[model samples]
Target: MVARKSAFSSEYSWFKGNLHSHSTRSDGKLDPPQVVELYRSNGWDFIAFTEHEFYSYWQELSSDDFLVLPGIEMGLDIPKFGRCHHLLGIHKSGNGAKHLVKAPPAEKDGMAGAQEEIYRLGKEGYLTIYCHPLWSRVEWEDISELRGFTAIEIYNHSSEMENHSGLHLDHWDSFLRRGIKVWGVATDDSHHWMEDYCGGWIMVNAPQLTVADLTEALVAGRFYSSTGPTITDFGLDGDEVYIECSPAKAIHIVTYEPWGRSFYAEPGKSISSAVHRVRGNEIFVRAEVVDSNGKTAWTNPIFLDKKA
Candidate 1:
């Protein structure tokens, strides 16, 4: 029998949510209440208001069907590089969540200062996510040494629409190639709801829609990032890994060593499922699905070396 390692489980339900967003509390166009209503009315199960260096529970916005997660976005400028580091601090609960409202004090330390802030946030019960790298002008060397990130934004809709700085698959691959196990996230990072809302999100497989359950599912990598497509199932059985998703133009099985396979649908056609037989030596495997319209979904890598 082949070792089994899957990012999702059969026992959980899928809930859609965005982990990063803004409102009038920060530099966003809408107010907190409007942002909450916009997402809740559009079928989102939860959302985090990551105001710049501001923390709020937004308890009134939450309902039995919707959740408001405590969160903040913190940044530090690199001394001379014209670059910066922005991190999302999403708390499981309000406890200790306000600790990150204050910016990091050591600005002169550059990336070191940012890493320190990330570490500190983790200690305070916040799941830290490295924000848009391309938009921030972040190179691999700038953040290669930082640790404790639950995920990195592989696709930022706002960044992509404003410029083309979103979709940092290379940055994500760099970390995975280095044996780092951080997950990939797709977010709207929406400030202006006009064209920025709902372009990207994560479908989390959690036992419930509560903050605690969502946070636990995130920490366990029970989710897939997407711009449009939906991944219904993903897992490895024996030497083969399989994916079941919405109609797609192609499916690529990516591994750490470029030893994986890609399957493409014929012209004007689409595929809804595919499978790849993994080489026994692969250290990890992940899937990327591209729809005919160019929308994509990403599955978290299954670390073969760390199989349970």
Candidate 2:
């Protein structure tokens, strides 16, 4: 018998997905068919239709064969002179029962408003992850306050273009230093069905290929992030955190601690890296793999829950 590909093999351990996208229901230029075709053709296991204010209105799919997630992007702005734009809501599992709770507005217009909406989503039994927290005017309190954020994107592929500058890693370093326990997701955040738009993605480890399974894993932080590379695994012990990577060149193990700072363990070229001296009462650790071709991958934080 020919050597058959093992779906559960470590080499093919993750399910590739896009967490943010738009469709004809919102301002995105592509219809469902074209958008679905683009992602499916690119080998993505799943893609969410997070339109500006409404779910993709998925009734558009001629067949439910594709792993399409129903999600809505709730955009709210900060107070006077505060340009911070926030996104609330969830990439609802289209296969599940309807989620009827609408997030309430924290304020008429401001971060407070966005907060209320997120809380509402939570009340309705959905976990909301803050999208592009540093996008344009989006700002927040210290990394320590990140306690409730379901998760935040350390890197958003679509918004990475910082004006005329290059790659925008944003304030991800700050969150790490604070020992914030959150998953880092890399999403295409695509709107136009363009190839360059799907530059970001997350590799999720799920028992099976399905929206429900993937969504549950993501909410549990059982995944990693990347623009192009891929992370194998990450974990933390007493005062040390360990990680494993793929096609690994140089590995970076980053830990975020209290007193608002971060530390790094760069082990030149090893598939595994560990941080020995953890700081303060808490330490959130993650790992990165820089592929030989310059591409890179990231694993979600393996949190060290030390309460003081």
Candidate 3:
């Protein structure tokens, strides 16, 4: 495990960026600079250079308008099991740990290996996340039962395409059913920054645009996942709540009200209007939209009146 590295903070700003990527550092072709430049040139406010199973987070930026967080994928090296390779989201750039996979101890080994490594990072204050639990059809029944990372990605654009992994809705739904309050993220899983890439993203509503701001927003779950549709405003009032989307083909108000009443507003779930209505004892409410290509937009969950 690595120690806390030095890095710049986003200062409570909305730094739109990606959480997963591959470069020549691992199996991907692009270099760090080329990867950074591609996203920066394309209006991406931030990016995490998750090269491989090694922790190589970069800090120093070319200017204030852009910032890059150094990171790496973690887990095991068992490519055959498809249970290897999990993502660790590092906020601090250059805190070099260099230890990719901590070898299993012939003696004191069990779940201690993963628990120690993960907990050690958490103890040090890094914002870690579990990326694409199903990248290899890996199950989340265990990870969902544990508490280590702060967030999870319901959709990893790139992996979903190459691996043909399901949309991850099943896993996300599982977490919800268990009362797990972990935040949900939708990432481009971008490696190409150019071309037909760059649709999976999170729209975070914050007062500023910086890494610190974005990180805080993320930890607080103040964001929405989207493939294309961007939700502007969504919330509830008393027995009546509302949602506003950006030119939606259809708006579905998915409400997990009362923290356990799993209900969604879509073609077969609730009502359709490109807008929604909530007048009941629901604890949470949100909006979603789908295009003809089956792309979806997930709005941040909103709190509704518990007594409603």
Candidate 4:
């Protein structure tokens, strides 16, 4: 059987969205309505209002064309490092209607606290996304054993702009290399609403653009993350793993360490597709496309040992 977890399909439409953001409900520069207007007017299909420790369902801001997902970000302290763990909890259409009633009390037990909060969020019917490991100063060792996160932020636009610690592919590969089946995401943890609002986003393939459809797609890894590049298709058929993207400077088929391959375009030119013949022994496979400007798009890994 072919093992592939591809989000692309002719039947589904792609929607651009940012899963993490803030507003004046927390410390964001814009109010909730302004944040909604900012993304809506900018061509985004959806935005999640993940204000810190404050949960609100901005259903009033949503229209037939734009969606506002109910979301909140919980912070747990790592007293040892004086930093905090940021977990984004996003609810489906009807979920998380109540305010901050079910959120767990802030804990300071380092890794254990983070794990507990993740478990709590899942139990509360929210999909948890571990946010910005590099900005949190979390090492692979700190989160290798943590479980129940639907995805981790491989790139956070705000973290990259403010702290220069946005990309966390090393942490993502650590989870995948160990056979952990978590997905990766790129988000603009946008608080400032200026340059941070549109730096990173995801393209989700879903049947429709409702909160339920988008939430389900995100939970099933039916999406890919991007800073600028676009991944048109990615999947595996038998031993042939393939990916098609926009004109790119380089395309990489990422697999188990020491086993993957990279294809680069010739000087003054660009390539748009690449294929890798799987050895039938690699743990998993994913794709990355890099544009001439060094912007990248990433696909979620497909575990070869599992059937499609």
Candidate 5:
């Protein structure tokens, strides 16, 4: 059998979305409608109202152009670490079951509770993401032990705004290096406390603006997260990996190794695309684009040993 390859085609359209946001149902400033309007007006094709321990706004807020995905930010207080662990569960189906929506009890808190909840929600057809590990001051040991999460927040806008604890690439790379098949996602995690609403979002390649399509695309890793730049295209061609994006100062091919390939634009010149030869020993590779304005976009990893 021939070796499988990773590719991105022009058959699908890119939909911009913020997968984590809070409304008045939780500790957010705006109500559900206001939150929806904010994102819709700002050109987001989809939004997930991941209220803390609640999943109420499903059909009530969905529309033709704008899609609302039902989700909840499950929080558990870890006794050992004495910190709260938050997980984002975006349901595959818009309608959430009662049991999945409810939070786990305090007795089942901590690492075990987190793993249990992730597995449980995953069984119920939810995409579970470990939310803001750095912000939570989560130790690597704890994170490395957890399983069953679909993705982890590499960049969290709210966490960055509140504290300088948003970017967590090291934590993500650790898991990827260990053979865990988790993807990376960047979200606003917008409580709207600061300028967090549109700061971070994902560009998903889907057939249409529907929950099922979006979820499928996300699970398949046909997306890239960004704070500012747009990744127009990215894929691998034999030993070389290429990325096409908006004008950027730098395009980096991040891999399982500590050092990866990078293409930098000369002073006063901006580049929109670059290609790099992939090292044969690399376990996986992803792309990161940094615009002149200092904003960055991150692509999901492409496993070298597996079919795309």
Candidate 6:
């Protein structure tokens, strides 16, 4: 079989979006329309109103420029971990007329119940995202057995703002090393909608703004997560991987090994591109660009021996 390459191309448009957010339907302070307006005015192409255990804003409010994807945040308390597993489900369509799928009570179901709920929602045409692993204190073993997830939140805005336990790059790398074909996402997961909004987002390259096209792009790994920097282009050619991004102070090529290559710019200087050769022993490799303002953009891992 032919190797799978990056799905980014010049033919598609890069749309910035935040897939996890909350509204008054759940524990969030803002209502659905206010949440939509908050993201829209901040230059978001799409926003999923992922209310806690509720999926209501499907066809409620949207516009020609901005799209509101159907989604919900399902949570369950794990007795073993002493924390909750919050799963973000961005559905291809609304959950019928009721627009809500009540979660199993956390007291009785626990982790097993959360996994079952994830599977059920997966079957119902939802893109499942394991949310805030670090914030929840979820270890690698806790998620090793779980399946049916499209992505994991590498950076959760609210989680970081509230508790400073948001960045989960180690958890994501562990999953990739274990042969999980999961993608990484960054989201605001905005509750207060003030300091949390626009902090984390994903830039998706899709043909259009429709749910189908965006979902396809996400599943195909045609996107990159960012706190500030923008990944203009990235691809592999022969043994070398090329990356072009916004002006950055440093560009790092990280792998499943102790050491990886990095390029640094001089003080007050910004570099926009770099190329690195793939080492043979490397299991997988990904790129991260850090701009001068301490913001970063992260690319999904590309397995060296297999297509990604």
| Local accuracy by lDDT, each model | 0.87, 0.60, 0.58, 0.86, 0.83, 0.83
Say which prediction, candidate 1 or candidate 2, comes out ahead on TM-score. 1
Ranking by lDDT: 1, 4, 5, 6, 2, 3
Instruction: Show pairs that collide, candidate 1.
Output: none
**What is the TM-score of each predicted model, taking all chains together?**
0.95, 0.77, 0.76, 0.94, 0.93, 0.92
Which lDDT value does model 3 have at 233? 53
Candidate 5 total steric clashes? 0
lDDT of 3 by residue, 1-308 (tens): 23321112233334567766766667666777787787788777777766554655555543577766656655643334445436465553234533333322222122333445566666555677767767745565345445666677778887776665626766665565455656678776666633424667776655565556666777767777887765555554334445555554456656664332223344544332343445555555656676545678876555444332
Compose the digit string of candidate 6's lDDT tens values, residues 170-226.
Answer: 888887777677899999999884588889999999999988888888888889999
Error of 6 at 88 (Å): 0.7
Cα lDDT tens digits, model 4, 51-118, are 77777778888898999888889988776665668899888664646554445576556788889888
Candidate 2 lDDT tens digits, 1-308: 22422112354346787778876666678887888898888877777777665544354552444576666667776554646554534544544424223333345555556666666666554556667765544544522243455666666666664331223344565665555555677776777744446677887777666666777787777777776665555554444455555555567656554322233334564343434445635555556677666667777665555541
Model 6 segments more than 4 A misplaced: 1-6, 93-110
* Steric clash pairs (candidate 5): none
C-alpha lDDT (0 to 100) for residue 271 of candidate 1: 94
Off by over 4 Å in 5: 1-6, 95-107
Is 3 or 4 the stronger prediction by lDDT? 4
RMSD of each candidate relative to the true structure: 2.0, 6.6, 8.0, 2.1, 2.4, 2.5
Lowest-scoring 10 consecutive residues by lDDT in candidate 5? 97-106
RMSD in angstroms between candidate 3 and the native structure over all alpha carbons:
8.0
lDDT of 5 at 277: 78
Pairs in clash, predicted candidate 2: 78-110, 84-137, 106-113, 107-113, 176-256, 177-256, 177-257, 179-256
- Model 4, 153: alpha-carbon shift in Å? 0.2
- lDDT tens digits, residue span 134-234, model 1: 99998888888888889999999999998998889888888787778889999999998458888999999999888889998888888999999999999
lDDT of 5 by residue, 55-99 (tens): 554666788899988788888877765576889888776654342
